[model samples]
Target: MTTTYRVTLRNRNGVPLDVAEDEPIYAAALRAGIQLPIACNYGGCITCAAKLITGHVRQPKGTALNRRQSQAGFILLCVARPTCDCVLDVGVESHRGLYQNPFAIAGNRYPPDA
Candidate 1:
């Protein structure tokens, strides 16, 4: 059976996104038109790392984050799955003009159907 969790993230703009069930948190942000700075789509790079303000996350592969960071509530969007309804605060500084563009969109943006 497939598992899912609701995820909420606080962006640099202080905007929060309520992502639906079963989707990776990063994927959910992308769907919400939020571009999380990421280098590798995999867990190798920690660039997409974000701080978990509340809730649980499961990282089976554990590639995106080191032990210390994970223990400190840091999660790599590339490999993080919410174990419960969770909230995260973005770690990186968002590009100023990027979000202004209606064009700078997520590569694999697909939101759940209403």
Candidate 2:
């Protein structure tokens, strides 16, 4: 059995969405009629960047964020999977100035190759 998590989307006004432990938040949000900023679906860009307001997310394949950035509550929803119930502020690609830049990047350029 898969563990399902409830993620409250701030952009959607506290609408609740469910996602399996192994399912990415992006996919789950879409299924719940919620849309988040997204570009490279492979986790190479900040287009799908979001802020983790509370709880935890498993971003094992998300390369757009380094450990420091993740620790700062930043997460790429396109590749983030909820580990437990969480609250997230999505569609935050335009808020770059609010965050400090990371010295190390785990991904390629803006538009990652397929």
Candidate 3:
């Protein structure tokens, strides 16, 4: 048997959307008709960054956030998969100034050549 978790995302307007733990939070939100701010869908941008108010999540290693940011409860919704019941504060104002272009990195650019 598999256990599924619930995710609650609170937008800037204080609106909350319920999501599932299986898929990426951003995709879940889109299915629910919630438009979450996102630039690169592959964890290359911080546009979809959110703070975990409560609960845990499993994110890809390529997420733009550093160790400190991850430990501080920051998560990129584009790559975040809930591990347990979660509550997230979306559209974090503090993160608005922390944008970094993933493509700017010399070797980390997307669409790697075959």
TM-score of model 1 relative to the true fold?
Answer: 0.66
Best by lDDT: 2
Ten-residue region with minimum lDDT total, candidate 3? 105-114
lDDT of each: 0.63, 0.76, 0.72
TM-score, each model?
0.66, 0.77, 0.70
Rate residue 34 of model 2 by lDDT: 74
Q: Flag regions of model 2 displaced more than 4 Å.
A: 93-114
Candidate 2 on 1-114: residue-level lDDT in tens? 999999998767789998999999999988887777789997888778888889998776677775555556788888889999999877764354335533432363222211
How high is the lDDT of residue 41 in model 1? 68
lDDT of model 3 at residue 58?
A: 83
Worst 10-residue lDDT window for candidate 2 reads 105-114
RMSD to the native, candidate 2? Answer: 7.2
